[model samples]
Structure formats: C-alpha cells, structure tokens
Target chain A: MALTLSPTLSLRKAPSISDEEFRKLRDFIYSKCGIFVDDKRKYLFETRFGPRLNALGAKSFSEYFQILTLSPDKDKELASLFEMVTTNETSLYRDTKQLDGVRASILSKIIKEQRAKGKFELSVWSAGCSSGEEPYTLSILLHEELGPELRKWRIAITGVDLSPAMVAKAKAGVYQEYAFKTTPEDIKKKYFTPVVGGLKVTDSVASLTCFQSMNLNDAAATKRIPKSHLVFCRNVIIYFDEAMKKKVVSSFYDNLLPGGVLILGHSETLHKISAAFKPMMLPGAMAYEKI
Target chain B: MSKVRTEDLKPGLIVSEDVKSPDGRVILPKGGRIEAFHPMLLKGLGVTEVEADSGDDEKLLQAAADYTREFFSYANPDSPVLAELFLYATGLVAQRLATGWVPPTLGERMAQNVEHLSDVLPADEADPEKIVRHETELASFPESSLRLKAELESPKASIGSLTKLIGQDLGLSAKLLKLANSPLYNFAEPVESIQRAVTLIGLREVSTLALGMATINYFQGIPPELVDMKSFWRHSISCGIFAKILSQAMGSGMNPERFFIAGLLHDVGRLIMFKKLPYASTEALLYARENFVPIVAAEAALIGYTHTAVSQYLLASWKFPAMLADLINNHHSPKAAPDPRLAAIIHTADAMSNAVEIGAGRLYVLPDFDDESFALMGLPASGLAKVFADYETQAEQTISAFF
Candidate 1:
C-alpha cells in the first residue's frame, strides 16, 4: 500500500530569531533598560517580538534593532519594547499575607509613631506600580486606618511605572473584573464605582493617589522624587541583572526616610542584594526596616 | 443579641452587627447568614465572635438553602447544564449543611489540591523536558488497521470491498457482527453476516469501529495492575459514544466518527504518563484521591502540563489531523478553543462519562462542565436527560463490543 500523508498536516510556524540578531537585540535592550535576556530566552524574544516586527513592517530582528536604536522615534519604540517585556500581573490587595502585615503591623506602628511625634504627614511610594492597583490599594488601607481622623493628616500616595502607557492607565484608574480577582467584595464596592467596561476607582480613592512615568534604572530621575515613609517595589527588580538589582536596591535605600519600611515581593529576599536595611518579620509577611 | 463563637455559628444564623477583623475590616456584613465554610474563614482571619440576630432554626435552614441557590445562580444564568449542575451542587451543599459538614471554600480546596504540587515542580526545577517529554513513544497503527483506515478514507471505497477487507480479520468481523446485533443497534434480527452488518452499520462506522478495536487491542499489553485496562477502554468507548450522540443531538455538521476518535484518544496522554512516569502518575492519582480534585489539575500540579497537552503532543507526533489535535488539546476548557462546538461536545461527553461512574479507575471527581460552551451549543435542558439516558443505554453494548 502507498503511504499518503495529509496535505494539511504541517507544523504551526512561528517566526524564528537568529543567534546574531538575538545577541544584538538582547545587548541593546540590556544597555537601555536593565532587563537581561539570556540565550535560553531566545524563543521568548522571538515569539514576543515577531508581531512587533510585522506591525512595524520590519523584515528581520537586526532591522528592527537598527530602527529601535537609530530612529528619531527610538524613545517611543523603546517604551513599546518595555511594555511588552514587563509583565503587569497585579491586582487590588495582591498578596493578602503582605497586606495583612502592612495593616496589622506596619501601618499600625507608623500611625502610633506619627501620633507620638506630633507629625501629621505620611508618604508612600509604589515604585513600578504597573497600572496603579498597588497605590490605590495603599490609599484604601490608609483610609481604613485613619477613618474619621483622615482629615488630620496629609497623605501622599504616588505610583510610578517605567511604561508611559501603564502610567496613563494608572492615572485613569479603571480596571476590569479580573483586577478584583483577589479583592474582597466589600473593599471593591467601597473603593470602586461600576463603569461600562469595568470598575472605576472612586473619586475619593482616586484623589488620594497620583501617577508618574519614571524609569528605576535612571538614578538621577529616581533621586528627584521625595524620600517616602514606605516604599513598595515588589516584583520589579526580578527582571534586572544582579548589578542592576544592587543599584536599584541602594537607590531605594537612598529614597526612603529613616525608620521607613520597604516591602519586596514575597519571593524576593535582600540577602545578597543589600545589607543597609534590617529584615523585620511581620505576622504573615516580611518587611525591610531602614534602621 | 448574644455573641457566638465563630466555630459555634451554625448555618442560617444572621449577624446583627458587622463581624470585623483585627484591622477593622468588615469580614462579614450584618444580615449575612453564616455559610457552611464561613466559620473557618472568619477564624482564619482571627475573628472570634459575631453578634447573631434572633431567628428561628427553620427560617435559618431555609435561608441557607436560598443562599446556596443564589451562589450557584452566579454561574451562567442562561445555561440549563449550569442550572442542573447548580441544582446538583446545591443539593450536596444542603446535605452537608444538614450533616454539619463545613465544606472548604474553592481557594482552600485548590490550595489543598496543589499543596504538594509546588514541591514536585519547584520554581527552580521548571525544566520543560522533565515535566513533559518531547520524544513520546507512541506506537503507530498496525499495518492492517492503517490499510483499513486508508480504504475507509478513500472516496471510491464500497461496502462490498470494505466487508471483504474486514472479513479477512475474522476477529474484527465477528466483533462488528456482534456489535451490530447488540442493543446499540436494536436490530429485530441477528446480524449473522459481515456484508449485512457492514451495510447496516455503514462503511465509515464499521471501519471506524475496526480502527478503534485494533487500537485497543494493540494497547492491551499495558500492565493491567497499573491501569484497569477494561475500565479504561470502557471509559474511552463511553466518551466516544457520548460524543457521537451529543453531536447528532446538537445538529453539528461535523462527522460523528471524527468526534468518536477524538474522544477515544482524549486521555491517551494519561496512558503515556502512566507508562513513562509511573511514579509521578501514581502521585497525581493519590493527590486527586486525597484532595477530591480532578486528575488533570493534580497532573498539572505534579507535572507542569496536564494529560490534554500530552495527548495533543502525541497526536501531533503521530501526524494526526490538526483539528483532532486542537480538539483534544482544548477539550478540558472547550470555550477557549477556536472550534468550541466540537471541543464542547467532547468536553461534555467526557464529563458525562465520568459523572455516570463509567470512568477509568483513577480519579472519582467530575470534570467541570463549561457553562459558556453549554450555553453556546444552545442545547435544551429538556433534551439533556434523554441524551444521558440514551448514552447510558448504549454505553454498555458499545463498551462490550469495543472491549
């Protein structure tokens, strides 16, 4: 019997990235931003950037690279590149254990110390706040903590992201139902007003927060921001190389007030990153206190 | 107005005042009836007591049932399958309430299911090859079955020539005749000859059956102790039969035999998992058994991917049609597939096969029936009972014929 194969039986084709082009693009991206793309991540780059190449009408990765580096609109292209590489997988009140720690220990301690010192100001910086959920969440926590006495204090909740698009989204403060996956229903109801596409952060919550576009890799730009009482830079530094991580951590240290708190993502640790801050074990989370 | 301990709060007792956590967050609102799992949830958040409103026990029980129904109503309100599943789930919840059994919340249940999975596939050891082998060892169809399949696929093939070809294998011919005479066909007279059986059952169906039988016979060498081979074949055949029945019922223009083949090989990856990684496979089984989670989730937790992905890999490696590969790949979550109608049929059929307790002797949990898929099919709830009844009636004969 003659063997006849089906004419339609072909493997799904994905655009391939060559080795030389991958090296050039990876190095270019790493120099501009701290994101390190190793050899194993060649497929990741290929699959993610293939559509971008097609969209820009560029034929090859090397051509896309030249366009990104040499074009007058290079900054805009780089911003788009950052948007693709950075994952914005965040939600309101993410990491409940960490939030619990913030509420029960960190916030409570801060409130008591402020009242004792007769200080009436509190500032929190949500660094790398992709799409603004973290800052809004912090604002809500502050509102809950201060309650009727909120009028007595000056609060500043600033959210910053490297991506302009994310910063704009954070400023808009509207999110789909997916953003509330981990959020308590009551919290959502209290802080958000129902909108056509999704939920809009209530004016009260929206008023308490501000959004800014800033790159963490740019030390000069980062230093311009005021030192904050609490800095949240969770899940951001994981994308950076070891040296970049150390630089960012030290900058965070410089950007925090004395006796301030810095919270990292749950999986992150400061063991090899920095020794400037002392680790404080809260109930269900960990915080680094600037002693 | 009395304060009740979180653990002592019974279902249907409404809170008169807000139950707040240590952080002053309202854990449960006033007028909220304590659910079966609420006590644990409250306790987990460090709530000790809630002020209960004055209410009768009968009123509370009624309130609890209403709450259970309301909870399930959030799942596709338009889907009758969802409605039926809701009714079933609510009944179970009511029974548990009566027995004073506090069911775990979905998150708790998932956490329990995946507690050990994290250890198996740690963050650092996420090697794709270790989790899922790229080079799968799937046996090809035997020469006779291949020729039979080719002949069946040929446009000019006739019942006479197909009957003659099938008659060459006396075992296959006899099985076909027996299946034709079985209750599945409901023939008044016995199908004594291969020609008449082939004519009655049609050339495509007979060939499909022969292919199915040949494949099952080929895989019969798998250790019976590792898997109950009879029950496995029964489940596969049952799924295939259900898929065919559902497609016909749904008025889908796709060939019923294609669905049959898709369903038959949907969990073939599980067999590969069992054969290749017996230890991990057994661990997945044990996790499912202990946690009351589906075997697929357990497999994904223990290994990175589920049997569905493995099956897709095997099918693709075997040079099967893309549609077949795609259907099996997305069978578990049919709504995600491009050809959702086909995937939904197989998904529903697979779930029904498991729900009716004709499953391969592994996990006893029912796969979640996708509401969107069910709603998309627009299958009347009235016809569902009849479809299931028809499947049940035909399943035994079909299983016996294939086995």
Candidate 2:
C-alpha cells in the first residue's frame, strides 16, 4: 500500500540504503546534476522514493540507483523522479490569492498595455513544469481573457523539466479534476473535455505550449529559448540549496527580455542575487518586473 | 577462459543465433552480427536516424564486435599516451637484442673469448678489449631476414639429407661452414661447405635457429614509436640482460643472451598483430577480458600463431641456432621443452621487466606463464632477484644505441 503525501513525493515503505552505496549514488548525481543533496537525509530520499522503489520492484535503493545507471533512457526516468521528488504539486491557479494579484496586477497590465503596442508577443516559461497542469492553466486563463486577440499575439507557454517522464506526461497534455483545486469551475468546463480516463486538455491548450526536458544547470543551451516575457520559476528553487537558488535566479534574470515579468514562490525572492528585477507589490502579493 | 560469444564477430561472419535490437522490440532480419561494431555504434549515434549502419562495421560481425564497441567507447579519443609508450618501449628492447648487442652475460665460449679479449688477444697494436667492445660489436653482421610466417609454410628437410638444400643459399652455406669450424664443436674439424655444417649442427638446432635469426630482423623492419629511442631499446635490452643472467644463475646453460633475445622478441608478435590486424588485436584483448581468457590464447586463435611461435619462426629464419630459437619458442611450455632454460629465463625476465614497469609499463592483461618452471629449474628466488636488480640498474646506456 502506498502512503499519502502532503504536496510531496512519498513511497509506501522505506528500503534499506547502505552507507557505501548511498555515498556513491549521491556522488554520481552530484557530479552529473550539479545538485549536492546530502545523503545523510536518508529519511528524505527513502520516504519520498519508497513507493517508486516498491512499485519498480527494485530490491533496494542501491538497485534502484543501479537501474538508473543502466542507459540514457533509463536515466531520464530517474531525472523525472528527481524533479518530482519534492513534488511540484501546484494546482490550476494554486496560491489563489497570488493568482488574484496576477490577474489584477501582472495580467491586467499586460492585456491593457498590448493594445498600445499594436502587436504584443507574450511568452511564459514555467520552469520545473512537472505534469503540465500549471502551463495549461496559464494557457486557459490567457485564452479566456484575450479571446481572438490572444490567437493573433505570438504567445508561447514553454514548460521545462529535467525529467523526461514528466515532460512526456506534460506533452500528452491531460489531467483530472483533482488538478483544478484552485481553478474556477466555469473556466474548467470551458477549457477541458471529459475523456475516457481523465479530463483531456483541449486542442487549444496543447497547441499553445511546448514541453521539453531541460536541465537548469545547462542554462546556455536553453538560454536562447522561449525568450519569455514572463517566467514562473515558482516552488522549484525551494528544494535547491542557496547556491542553486542563486544560479536558477541568475539564469532566469539572464533569459528574460527587458520590461518583462518574473514570478517566484512566496518564500523565494530576488533581493540579493537578482537586483535587476524590481519588485511590484500589488494588493494580494508581489510580482517582479525586469528593469 | 573461453572467448565471449558476442565479441568474436567480424564482417562476413556467420552466427547461429539471431540478435534482437537493444530494446528487443525488433529483431534484425536474418542477421549475422552486424559486421563492424565500434564504427557502427558511432554511426548509429551519428545519424539522426530514421536509421543507419555504423559505416565502420555492423553491430554483429562475429561474437566480439559488441565487446569491441564497448572497449573503444571507454577508450579516450585523446588516446592515453601511456599505452602508446608501453608498446613503443617494449618494441625497442626487442629490436636491440635482435642485432645490436651480444653481451658477456649471454656469451657462449665464442662470445666469452671475444668478451675477455684482454686476457687472450695481442695488445701491442690496439686494446683488443676496446676493439672488441667498440668496433666488432657494432659491426652489422650480414644476415638474411624473412618472415617466419613464410618459413612456417616452407618445406622442411631431414638433417641427414638437407645438405643439398642448405648449399643453395650462399649466406646459409657460408654461415654453416664457418659455424662448423668455429671451434664450437668438440669433434674433429670436418668442416668444408654448407653440407658439412648441416651434417654437424644437428637438425633441430640448425633449422630452428636459421628460422629464429631471419625472423628477428624481419621485426626490425617494423619501426616502433618511442620518444627516447634509447630508453625504449634500453628497457628491452634489460629484459634480455636479466633473462641471460637468470638463465646462468639457474645453471640451465640456456645461452642467456639468446633467451634475452627471445624475451625481447616475445612481444614482437603483439607488434605484428597490431600493424597487420589492428581490430584482431583489439578484439583479442577484449575477448580476453570478457571471457577471462589470457590474451595470448585469444591471439593464437585470432591469428594462426602465438607471439612465442611467431618469435620462434622469425628467429629461426634469421639463422639463429636452433637450440636458441626453440628455447625461446617453448619458453611458455617449459616442462615439455628440451631446453627450458631459455623459457625459464625469458618468462622470468619478461615478468620482472614488466613488474618493474620496464619496457611496456602496464600490461593489458598479465601473462599466465608457468611459475612451476622456476622451481623445477632449481633457481632460487634470490638468484632471480639479483638478475632483475642488475637489469634495473644497468639497462640505460645498453638501450641507447640501437632502439
């Protein structure tokens, strides 16, 4: 039986991880991913990956890590696990209070300003877009508010993750009603269709967005990417250590065009590392504007 | 150990089992192992496939191509210079023993007489020792060089009736007559022509040595790459030196110098294999690792002969004494050998030289020579150590001139 998780990855039962193999596995990942997750946090990894371990029928954590090392395709599956280990479990318009600020402050300004710009080309990159729900919701919000004008605008909603598996699911572009936790019902009814297994994201949502497997450490490769007018690098940086947070923020700052927008999780900020992004505190919460 | 089945394939190979694609979703239609693997995998990754071949070889040629691919993949493209140095250095040592030096250590009575010329020769005109050392030693002897491969295929003759055949080649005829009269024998001076030399030297010694000498100089034609050509030759010469010194210490009277020469040329087969059949050598190494077989056995199977046999044939054709050539040839097969002295000497010296990182520093796979031979030869461990120490200390200038 699998254990329930609180907006987090979980396994049913913890597998015993020997100190030696754990060190080696940790070292391997640190070398490859540039992420130095402490192996001492046996509880963290075990609790998170237990279900996956049992489900995959791997004898132990070492065996699971060994399987991850088998081939590039298999390694991609591990990368997806790494991405979802902390669970990027945001629902449609999650943190609804902040979503309200996004409507009143950020989105309202962009929609109003685009009329003067003549041809507004908006782009958004939802970094660590696990399972595709967030970007599709953003797509639904844009389509509902902007209508045919949104179609005329060269809009891009790029979702990127290190996990090929999550990226695959993201590309398939389907979700269930559970994904609509903060989404308004009328919006869901208008945007999704009742399908055989789950609610299939409409053709319109899939058409507007592209999902790709990308490593944040490999920023140079994805730097010339979406050329996003807005970025939702929320929740992803929390699991990262300070250095990774600084790095992810710097990459985000480097990628955005001037006079664009950057959003972060409530606890995340650009105060020290990213001085170029000026804070815009609206009624509900804060958003960042590119200088 | 047996050769891994997958690793032995090459182009134009036929296999009994069908191989499936890596995912096992598709079976290659009626396939032999894809012909060449290293090139194939590189190509498969190369093409943004709808699909393609490795252009070097198909995945399955024989059983070994996959192993070959796996080996090259781990091989750094920059090429590890150490491995290159090892091949070159060992080659130089073998080269020097072939023609350059005839050591006091390996000297027979003839060699000993020349070595100790100060005690015996006239000293009024010139220091005979200096003349012997500086002048005669460096003088290149007129010797025929031929591939033992050809000689192995050549017709053999019985000693009693081979004189006519020996009389055909002038150099062979002259060397035989000279050797018959060189006071090397205890018998009366009955030397006249090639036939007399043939009649006296004994069939096994004459034929094998003739083959050994010619074979060595053939290896000399194959140049090796070494930055300090001197050091390279020196290390090989050292292996030879130690082989000789150890042979005497063992009281085997195996003609230490020839054993040294034998030890020096043992790896020449490796060179010949490298130059003539590179993939075969690579496959040999891989199959050895994969199947846990010693690489030599893999080489023997892939090529027609082992390094010992090749070295033997080569030396025999070079007109070396059959005793010396056969000694070297059977160095790895001592118990059955009539002359295990060279085998003991070469095997011990080769191991020591490599152990001390002498010629080719690190071995791909260590040789599985019989250690029991050393005990049977009555050579104590201490005697072996002394020779090894001597080779280690003195191999420098010795290697300089030839390699």
lDDT of 1 by residue, A1-291 (tens): 000112221111124667788888888878877777755456545656767988988888878988898999999999999887775456687667668878898888888999999998898888899999999999999988899898899888989998888999999999877667668889999889989878999888888888898888888988988789999987777677789999989988998999999998644567678889998877545689997
Model 2, A1-291: lDDT tens per residue?
Answer: 011112211112356566786677677665555566553244345545656778888888778887788855686566656653434444565545556678777886776777678857788899888788778878877887788877677788999887777888888877765566456778778888888767788898788899998777676766867677788876566446567767877788877877778887543456555677788875445678888
Give the C-alpha lDDT of model 2: 0.53
- Which residue pairs collide, candidate 1? none
Categorize the docking of model 2.
Answer: incorrect
Writing each residue's lDDT as its tens digit, candidate 2 over B148-229 gives 2223334664654455444556655554454345323324766676555556655544554455434444445433431123
Fnat for model 1 comes to 0.00
Model 1 B-chain TM: 0.65
Q: Which 10 consecutive positions of candidate 1 chain B have the poorest summed lDDT? A: B110-119
Candidates in order have lDDT scores of: 0.69, 0.53
Model 2 regions more than 4 Å off: A1-14, A34-40, A47-67, A70-77, A80-86, B1-403
Could you tell me the TM-score of candidate 2?
0.38
In candidate 1, stretches whose alpha carbon ends up further than 4 angstroms from where it belongs are A1-14, B1-403
